[model samples]
Structure formats: C-alpha cells, structure tokens
Target: MAVSGGIAAYKSAELVRLLRKQGAKVRVVMTRSAMQFVSPLTFQALSGNPVHSELLDADEENSMGHINLVRWADVLVIAPATANTLAKCSHGLADDLLSTLYLAATCPVYVAPAMNQAMWHKTVTQENIQKLKSHGVIIIGPEQGDQACGETGFGRMSEPLAICNRLMDETPTRCLSGLKVLISAGPTREPLDPVRYITNRSSGKMGYALANAALKAGAKVTLVSGPVMLSPPVNADLISVETAAQMHAAIIGKAPAHDIYIGAAAVADYSPMITEQGKIKKQDDQTTLTLTLQKTRDILAEVAQLVNRPFTVGFAAETHDLEQYAKDKLTRKNLDMIAANWVGRDLGGFDSEQNALQVFWKNGQKNLAMTDKNQLAEQLISLIAERREYERGNKNTA
Candidate 1:
C-alpha cells in the first residue's frame, strides 16, 4: 500500500486496517508530505509492518530495499494519490519512494485519487489520469461527495470498505465465457415533436458497465443504446437508437439469436398518440393544450413471452416501494431476473456514478450495496452467470 499527500491521507490509515482485516499482508509506503498528515507510526501499527517513507534509508536500503519492496508486493495500491503523485507516476518520474515503487512494481497497480474538484478537473490532471489508465493502471474512484475542501463535484476517495471489496473482486473468473449477451441501455425518448421529447435521466452508465463486464468475461456483447454522451466499450457491437419505438424494434429484431438479454434501458412508457407534423403554433388566448398518449411497447414483457426466449434481465428504477415494485415487475413480466434501484433521489441512481441494486429472481434475491456502476455491474453479471448455470444443471437433471 502507498499513501500520498492529501487531506485524504488520514483515510489511508483506515484503508490499511481494512486491507489487513481482509487477510491481506499490508506493507505501507508513504510520501514525505503524507507523514505530516498522519505519522508513519499510525500506518506501521495498523499494517503490522515497518513503514517505508524514503528511498535513502541505509538500514532499509542495505539490501536494495526499493527493488525488494517491489518484489515483495503482489499488488500495489495507492490511496489518496494526489495530483502531484499522479503527475509524477504518469510521466515515469521515480523521484520519491512511492513513485519509485510505482515504476519498479511489476504487479498490477490500483490508484484511488483524492483532491479538490478543481484540481481533478484540470486538463493536465485529466491527461495524467488517462495516461495512467493507458498504461494498465486500475484507477478506482474519486467518487462524488463532500470533499475536505468543502466543494463537491467528483474528487473524493472511495470509502475504505468499497476499495477493499473491489480488491477482492478484481480477479473474478470468466464465468460467462462463450455466451452471447444482448443489452439495452440509456433513456428512450418519447418524441412530442421534432425538438421536444420525454425522457428520464438514465445516463446508461449501469448498462454500459454490464456490457463491458460481459465482454471481459469473454461473452460476445451487442449493446443497443439510446441517446447518451458515453463512448461505446471496445469489442462490443453497438446499435444506437433514439425513441422508445426504435429501441423496442431493435431489441426485438436482434434478441432471438442471443443467449442473454438484459433490458437495462429506461424505455419511455408512453408516446404521443398523435404527433404534430410541425411545431404547434402558440395561440395568444390558449390557456390549456392537451395531448393524448398511447402505451409504448413493453420490450421486456415481449421478450419474456417468446417461446424460445433468452435468459432475460430487466431493470426497474422506482421512487417508492422499491423491492415490492421490483418483485411485482419481475413476476408480471416473467423475467429471469430484475435489478432495481431507487431513482428521484440525490444519489445512487439515474445519472449518478454509483448505484445500489436489489436483484430478484423467482425464489432468490440478493442486495448489491451502493458502489460504482462498474463494480456493481460486475457483481450483477457474475450472479446472472451463476444462476444461468444453476438453471442448466436443474434442467439436465429433470
């Protein structure tokens, strides 16, 4: 474990304790300025190992300690990685003990950044982050929250337990290998006119994360996405759609050949019964103008009713009675699984970077607590794969 200088340096102590509690043998290395925030003794006590802070300590370096540190580590994790540390590591500068280990370490490196929102958004910092990612560093959260700086956009380190869980889940098995996955994502627009439409704030992050996870698990992935600003993940075929009608048609056309179908899109429930050929002219005396609506295609229910349907997953974003509504939808639509989350809140749904999911099947249920969409997606995919295999076993026996 490496700790860099930041207000979040204090949090690293707890992180070390959490890692050790999880049976990880933790050896902590701190930046010089990090010692100012929390003494090296704190980490040493928690990690149960000598804290390394400098590259020139003769007692520790008598046996090429820097190289030895790199060799001893199975995985290197840097929490509270400040802007300076990120810049140094990104540019391959090995000026300090932590940065030196970053250069020398052969194992996978994970970084959790902590800084002010402004610092994180700086062009140089963003470029450095991208460079680190390009070099295969697993960049974890700078999750959105109230930062120590008292301003919040997205520059807070993830909580210690979340980081610990991710470390445990990082090396998951390729459980969905050789399967075909079809996923729907983003909010489907219900157009009222050429420029006006009804849609939810579904950012599509959850669905995109699922697609990426399935691809990582060696599944052939096809993502049918509604309008979103996100780029498509590599190796997954992307089909872009706009309106609910178009999304429904695309899914219907392509879902039959896939082995798994996940309808993560928040498809519009209704569309205008009569669309105006042109924008309706405003009348000076008009006080109320009413338009009728008709139900949009229920894509999940349609897929579920197929005679040779794929293993289908649905998502329900609810504002009230989350689990009850989710279970009702699951049974009513006859879906293989349903992942539900509460929307219309300040966090953990819709456009937020993190979310919690309550997954439901017929006789079983699991709660995936709040975390980044990527980790949540990985867990969801793994659960689906496990259930799919279990069903297969039961079918063979029957």
Candidate 2:
C-alpha cells in the first residue's frame, strides 16, 4: 500500500492493520510528505515488515527497491492518494519511491483519494482521475463527509473497514459483459423563469454510484445526467442536460440502444406553462403571484413502454405510504423492478451520503438496509444482473 501525504494518512494505519487481519502479507510504501503525518515505524509495527519510503538507499538488493517490490506484490493499493500523488502518477512522473513503484508494478491498482473538497472537484484533478481509470486502476471511495480541514464534502478517504472489504472481496465478475446499460441521475430543473427554476433535493449520488458499479461489473455504460456538482465517472458515455424536457429527450433518444435502463434521476413532475421573457418584475405592493403548471414527460414510463424495451428499473422517494406507493408505481408503469426509499427522515435520503432501499419486482422483494450509496449500488447492480439472467433463462426454457 502507498500512503500519500494528507491528514487522512493516519487512516492508512488502520487499513494496514485490517489487511494483516485478513491474512494477507502486507508491505507499505509512503511518500515523504506522508511520513510527516505518520511515522514509518507505526506502519512497520502493524504490517510486520519494514516500511519502504526511500527511492535510493545504499542498503540492499542493489538499490533497486522499486523493481523488487513490484515483483513481490500481487496488488498495489494507494490510500490517501493526494492530488499531487495522483497528478504525478497520471502523468508518469516517477521521481519518488511510490510514484516509481507505480510505474514498475504489474499488479492491479486501487486508489483512495483524499484532499479538500475543492481540490477534488477541480477539473484538472478529475481529469487525472479519468486517466488513471482508463489505465485500469480501480478507485475506492473518496467518500463525502467531514474533512480534517473543517469543511465537509467529498474528499475524505473511505473508512478502513470499507476499504478492506472491497479489497478482500473477489474480483468483480464480468456478469454484464457484452451488455449496454443506460442510467439517469440527479435532479432535473423545471424553469419558472430565466432566474428561477423548480427542482428536487436529489444529489445524484445514488445514480452516480450505480453508474460506477455498472462499469465495474463489465457493462458498457451511458449516463444521462441532470445538472449535478459531482464529476462524471471515467469511460462512461455522458450526456448532460438540465431541464426536464431536455433530460427526457436525451434518455428517450438513447434508451433503445441500451439493454438495461435505470430511471434513477429525480425529474420534475411539472414545469411552468409559460416562461417569462425576463425575470418577473417585483413590486412593493405585490403580495402573491401565481403561475400555471403543466405535467412534464414521464421518462421512466415511456421507456418501459418502448417496443421490446430494455429491462427497466425505477426509483421512488416518498415520505408516506412508501410500500403502497412503490408497488403502485411498479405496476402502473409496468416496470420490471423498483427500488423505493423514505425521504424527509433524518437518515438515508436526498443530499445525504447514505441511503437504504426496499426493492420490489413483480413477485418478490428485498430490503437493502441503509449503507453507503456506493455499497448499495453494488448490491442493486448484482440483483439487476441476476434478474435479467433469470428472465432470459425462463424465455429459453419456454
């Protein structure tokens, strides 16, 4: 494991401990800056091996530590991969031990990024992440939450347990190989005027998680996204749209070419009947103003109704009558599956980092309890793949 400089570097210690507990021989390599936050002795104690950080030493193996380390390792994991480290690796700069080892290693690589939220969101940083992904590097969570910098967003390294579980799990099966998956995400705005619009609390986290999970499961992914602050996953074909009408056109136009469609976007139910040419004038005397609303296109329902349509899944977020409403939509829209969850509660809903789902199909249902959106996404994707295979088997037998 490579530990880069970040406050999250301390977490890498626990990650090392967990990997040792999982019965894996461990080696740790650190950046110079990382040594400032955590001592090399700490890692050496936990890993039961010497920690390596120097690019050049008169010590052993002819001063070719980078080459020897790569030969002995089956996998390379870089935790708390700082922006500097990421940029260096993406651009093939091997001036240090960790970066040099990254170049020489022939093993599968995983990176868990850590930095301030702003740095993580920078266009250049995201582009570097894309370059790494294109080279087959698996990205673990830079999960959203409190940061050491007293700011909260998506730059925190994932918890050690989550990282350990992800690494220990067998490599993801290529179950959806040779299939196309279409996903919609985020909230669609319905313009009330040039300056104002209607939208929901959807953060697009769940949808984005699903897209990433699909990509890991060996599917060709096309993501139709509404306006969102999050970065798009690398390698997925992306189409960005804002308003409900535009989202509708994008999804419907692309739906036929895909084999599975997940309507995870929180599209507006209604839009203004008329958009003012300019911002509505405000008057000191004006107490209230009313405008007409027209129903927006039902993107999920329409896609489900397409001839020989892809297996379709929909999401329902509700505050009351959750099961009844979810089942009703599942039947009314002729959906193959629906994942419903509660909103307006204190936990696991829009804008939050975690979520839960009560998933239903025609004759069965499963409850996916509250968890990180990314983990929940993997479960959902596995279920979708299983159901699709079952449906195909039935058709062949019939």
* Candidate number of the best TM-score: 2
How many clashes in each structure?
Answer: 0, 0
Off by over 4 Å in 2: 1-76, 79-166
Tell me the TM-score of each prediction against the true structure.
Answer: 0.65, 0.69
lDDT of 2 by residue, 25-52 (tens): 9999998899999999999999999999
Q: Give lDDT per model, in order.
A: 0.87, 0.90
Candidate 1 least-lDDT 10 residues: 130-139
The worst-scoring run of ten residues by lDDT in candidate 2 lies at 130-139
How many clashes in candidate 1?
0
Per-residue C-alpha lDDT of model 1 across residues 201-226, encoded as one tens digit per residue: 88888888888778767689999999
